[model samples]
Target: MTRGWPARLSSGEVTLRPLARSDRAAWREVRRRNADWLRPWDATVPPGSDARPSSFGGLVRRLHRLARQGTTFPFAIEVSGQFVGQLTVNNIVRGSAQFASMGYWIDQQHAGRGVVPRAVAMAIDHCFFTAGLHRVEICIRPENTNSLRVVEKLGLHEVGLAPRFLHIDGAWRDHRIYAVTVEECPGGMLARVAAPPETG
Candidate 1:
């Protein structure tokens, strides 16, 4: 029922597109393969949690509904045209506070190639330049060096730490909040990554 939302965004070597029901198989395979690798960071319900495990069909439905409400952009990250992982722009806020939170996971195979950073840069750029949003933020567990590097490369300013910020893999986790505003990136986020590393 949601009409005219273009499902694709591409830049450099990565592309981000809306996650669909048709991606179930690809999603499952990647998730299964990365289960052990990603379990520690997986978002899961807390102890004695009554939350039901999400179903693929139900997830797609919810994502579509959220998209219709303009509060989330659930996407699949692809590189060289192969589905690799997921990056979601969630907790979108409008009105006086135009901001959203980002969360992502990439296949272990793709972890070190700058795939996540490229995809993240594209998502934040779209949120600011095209979607008319004012701010974007990414929260990472302090021990998550990989996730930390993504924001570090993008130069997202670390705002502060939130104690017990999000439940992950069955327990509450602390998070380092990193954020950027439209006032900071007048040109674009992707443009910054694409810029040559300054040499002294």
Candidate 2:
């Protein structure tokens, strides 16, 4: 298992650190403000499912448990010292298949400006180098142009499409799978995203 967990990763002004109970108010404010903006892309509990809704405290506790088990790494995305969003690496697999899936959301006010992309690059770098993970995957709804753009900017390859991949926005939705292996970004994801574009 990875020794250090609940780690802090940063790239420029964007930082990814463990979400804490103390962040309750700030996290709630961002979620409330972006509720409408995020509705279409947010994951929802399927109707009639046995899963109970989780309160903020419950959610944080669960994330902490997962982190201790080395199965998940949850992060609060902060920009220049302000909480603005979340990035979670979930469903980690070890042994011969060292892989994980990543999911994220940002406050509408912080959308674009390369915040999410920078945060993602930092997280993936940590997963590969620090966590001893191989590949990382991000599944995005086709209609979510904003999320699709992040993977595009980072040059993550589109692996395929998954039908009814997840229950999101009140229904099972298809998602386009985007992934990057450590081999794909040998120098590190942060460096790749930070490098200036080449001109012919």
- Candidate 2: where are CA atoms >4 Å away? 1-4
Which stretches of candidate 1 lie above 4 Å from their native place?
1-4, 47-53
What is each predicted model's overall lDDT from 0 to 1? 0.89, 0.92
Task: Summarize candidate 1's per-residue lDDT along 1-200 as a digit string, tens digits.
Answer: 32224458998679999998998999899999999999999888877867643788888888878899888889989988888999999889888998999999999999999899889999998898778889999999999999999999998999999999999887899999999999999999998888898899
The residue-by-residue lDDT of candidate 2 on 31-84, one tens digit each, is 998889999998888988877438888889998888889899989999999999
Model 2 residue pairs with clashes: none
Candidate 2's error at 68, in angstroms?
Answer: 1.1
Sliding window of 10 residues with minimal summed lDDT for model 1: 1-10
Candidate closest to the true structure, highest lDDT: 2
The ten-residue window of minimal lDDT in model 2 covers 1-10
The Cα RMSD in angstroms, rounded to one decimal, for candidate 2 relative to the true structure is 1.2
RMSD of each: 1.8, 1.2
